[model samples]
Target: MTEEARPESPDIPAAEFEDSDLLRPIVESGVGFRVTSSLLLLVLLTGWVIFGRQLLYGLGVTGLNQPVAWGFYIVNFVFFIGISHAGTLISAILRLSQAEWRRPITRMAEVITVVVLAIGAFHPVLDLGRPDRALNIFTAGRLQSPLLWDVSSISAYFMASTVYLYIPMIPDIAILRDRGVWPHWFYTFLAWGWEGTPRQHAVLERAVSILMVLVIPIAVSVHTVISYIFAMTLQPGWHSTIFGPYFVVGAIFSGIAALMMVMIVLRRVFHLERYLKQVHFDYLSRLLLIMSLLWFYFTFSEYLTAFFGNEPSEMRVFFYKVSGPYAPFFWAMVVTNFLIPVLILSFRRTRTIPGIFIASLSVVIGMWLERLNIVVPSLANPRLPLPTGYYIPGLVEWVMFAGGIATFILGFVIFARFFPLISVWEIEEGRRLSVAETTERLEGYLPDPLPSAPGQPVSEGG
Candidate 1:
């Protein structure tokens, strides 16, 4: 029988435990990596060309016009930022809850949040017609402007998430240092002279714990402030007290879906079936299902309020979503976001890898549609219709979208090549923790170890 088929025994070396699950996937995702990297580079070069054109010729190259100022770029901005929320939520929230399974997964989720947040945060600058005047937002920055709120909250969230990703990474960096494969100076620089001493470990643990506790609210606030940017405007479809929670929930919903997709791709690419087991997929599927329901509830409430209140601006935007040019996208969002995920994830068999993959893919696409719906239709149906605004995305927008996604892939690809994508130290830590947690749970279930044969005096400890 294969090693996997053999029953696990105590004889298994503890050293074998270290983050092998994470390494397995990285090892397996082979040569095609170079191809993906090359493609990403080409895309990045193209994006630069487009960006240069925009910079030189101005925002005139894009379909963006007056009133409908924000278009695909902002949609993607919100979409990507929402995706960033998932990593910290998974890594920090689950870590705080003492979920033993979090060890192998937290690193990937945390990296996703940091990288995607970087991409998302840059988008507003891209949206600015006068990016050269960008510092003016800060120099003459109005504390009252929702735009300024976005700049502040996004910057804070980025800093917090980056620190969160770096803290746990120190141990792994120490591992790499020990491996002795480096530019000497480069690894030395990043390793921060880590010795992994007991004091160092203790300090690192304390830092991570504090950051995890701190990041949740910051993550929530970042998205809330993002929603406030829209809601603070009295514009149709943008104004709603519920917008804050709605954006946060939607951010998490999309973030989790994006996380599932990343995990799936990495698993397939890296061949980490052992570490990223079916159990992880199953749990993720259930979470996705829950988020789907939550999203549906929020979407329903938001729309129902708009429909029933008969407010002209809100109703105009709502009907435009349902029956206007955006009708197909809106309904498609319903099907993909709600119907598909709910049906597939609800079934046990459908919680498997392929099923969850379908659900996650659908959710990602649907969430993008939702962002587009929120942005465009409202702009299209202005309070004072200037010939019913039309947003025809030009080449610049497409290049930017492609660049953002390419950058995401590029970052992961580079990470996979340089360092083990999985947290080696954490995985080992997890196995020990998992066994301990399981034993504790099982002890609770079992009859007390027969209070040691009267005065036979059971050895106090196992």
Candidate 2:
């Protein structure tokens, strides 16, 4: 196969070998990467063991019961799926906007989307108590049901996300294929005969553009449909019209937070300080801060509508969340989602890496509580004559939860082990083209450069 021409980025060091060093994760002698990956794999196995145990003992071995039956599994399912948005949606937006800083971050973002989506999708089957019969969604399922929407949209998203992630990696994989990395045949196959001809490069860019356009709507639809599961219901908190946008906003909020944490972790682990610089973290934290404010606004708007309407059933549920049994979690959600992030990220002095890390972690915890707030309180205090219900996830659920996280970490580690976490070609391409590309793009916005002083030697097209 013909080797693709490697464009040199001026910003990259002259040695060109530093690029090889960046590729070291895929081709080196690193003890820590191996040991940590092994540890994470062992933990992931425990999660699978829990899944198998639940399959054997049936759903009864866990804490699920009346009203609160949608427990930690659903909460985490939503939370993880929400985290998936942090990757593809933001990546697509940044890419479409031609944001230069996105180059280093999009790869991890898409990886997060694919990995966590697989994890999140597992929960429905876990909730089912009989996962083998999952195909019955086709045999005994109704398209009219909201569950079908979740199934269908999420499936579409998984397929699209996988393709979206894989296509862009082709040139990079081809790089590996040429280098004759240990997995030579694997990279060769994924590279898909990409010769990186000018025409091929054009086609690749066009394909990414089309997919970028397509993925944004798919991503939005995925979360909107998820919200529909609650909005379509008649439950007190779930029945609001704002539920759809609220959930989407919360998804992006948690997603940005999760992405921030992932960014920080990956930066530290792979020694990607040069690529994933402080500015990247600072810019991302700003987005996280914006989402935090939006989250607060939605939370306020949602409660204000409910509280002002004086809907007795809604108020009952509201009071339970605000002052009753779930009050601690509710306020904790507030503190983490709003209070901590705003306090830390709002000020320039506190928006440093550590400050952002604190906010990001707090936002993640807060968002989990937000998911819990949405899923549990209303169900526990259903309007029916049934007595108050509560849910506390037993060992199986918690184990499975921990396992999913371990699986995510393991997936990321394995991926980094095989491939460069940052896109080598994209960064190089940016370094070569970003200045001129940016200049041309900005020139489009300036009204023909003030008409070139009316006729005083207009320059070319200007």
Candidate 3:
């Protein structure tokens, strides 16, 4: 393998490794470098115009109305939040399970979780009919309201996830500082003068380990609290005990799909196939498939119970989803979320890179539909038996949606431009640990490494 394609061995000092096998290509690739920059500026300008419109005309310009106070903004909010769950859960699970292949992918995933969470969590304020009265959420905020639960839990999730991303990033930031390419003062400030000394490394490791354990529960709580916003409401379609786990599972499902899609794009754009190998895709595909099944299970249970129980309100909402105006989206969600991914991923041959990409794309679409299903159908079938009005997002909402996507691309692209998108140092550590672990496993199955006398030369196996 080429030097740029191979990770440094553990024996090599991290300080001497100027470029990592995983991240060098990304830094040097120049892919999406200019396109993302221009797009970011465009998105920013467009977003400004949209917000200006909203400011001038007020929330009346948007589709939100009495009773159905949330619309595309809220749907996008949930979609983004679900996608944010991708990083924390994947990183924590991989760390907890000690997955060797997670080394290169973890940082990107964690960064996505942090950034998307910030974007998603803010969306509610944007949805407020009278946004200037937003502080009413605080001054008159009832702790009893599910909205308050959402506020508390999402804030906690954001803080926890951000810390999770930052803690691991400090060591890498220190590496950048040592290289003298980053803004010296800025990186120096962020790095906190990490010397990579044994003592500092030990403390960093302990802190990261503790945070990893802490973050999982916080992540779960965030999604659960979001679901509670619907469930705790006397809403017909949402009042169920199943919502907490259902939302959590759906968040994780969508999160992994987003992660896989990001990894695919980054791998091709930055030519990271060497570090983020086919094996990584293979493993992640299996994970995505597993999540697909779990999502299906939850969805089935949720809808089935509602349908079978036949409560007037719940049945009205459920049938609206099944056969009403939203039926196209609802069925499309099933096809995309379950059928496409499950079929393609279940077969080993079809689990190749391109196939996996298609499956990931399907999952992304499906999960977005899932969010829409959760948001729209219930609103369409209110218990009051009033005429169901359609919701078409205003131009401002559309612009903001596009802007949100552009911002995500811009942030990740800029990050890739400056820092190694992959964790160079972690890849090296993984190489050593993976080799050691594999060797141990092999020894259990095969002949042991040949022993040598005290003064004799050792065999290659040794």
- Report, for every candidate in turn, its global Cα lDDT versus the true structure: 0.84, 0.87, 0.82
1-462 per-residue lDDT for model 2 (tens digits):
232354432322333454566688887848988799889888878888877878888988788898787889889989999999988999999999989999999999999999999999988888996688899999999999998999999999999999989889988887777777887889888889976676778889999999999999999988898889888999998898998888889999989988989988878877888998888988999898889899999999999998999988899889989999999999999999999999999899999888888999999999999999999988998797788888888999888988889989888988898888898888878867788989998888877544546657655672
Q: Return the clash pairs for model 2, or none.
A: none
Index of the highest-lDDT prediction = 2
What are the TM-scores, per candidate, against the unseen true structure? 0.90, 0.94, 0.89
Worst 10 residues of 2 by lDDT: 6-15
**Candidate 3: worst-modelled 10 consecutive residues by lDDT:** 3-12
Superposed by TM-score, candidate 1 places the C-alpha of residue 453 at a distance from the truth, in angstroms, of 19
Tens-place lDDT per residue, model 3, 1-462, is: 333333433323444354455445433545457766886979868887888779778888887776666898899888899999999878988987777778989999998888788788878877876788899988999998878988988888888888888877777777667666446787789888776656666687898898889889888988898898888878888888999999899899888888988998888877787778889988988988899999999999999999999999898888788998888999999999999999999999899888988998898889888898988878877788688756777888888888778777777877776666787667766655679886787689886766766887675452
What order do candidates take by lDDT, descending?
Answer: 2, 1, 3
lDDT by residue (28-123, candidate 1, tens digit) is: 556677788998999999998999999999888999997778898899999999999989977898899877777668888988998899999999
User: How does residue 178 of candidate 3 score in lDDT?
Assistant: 68
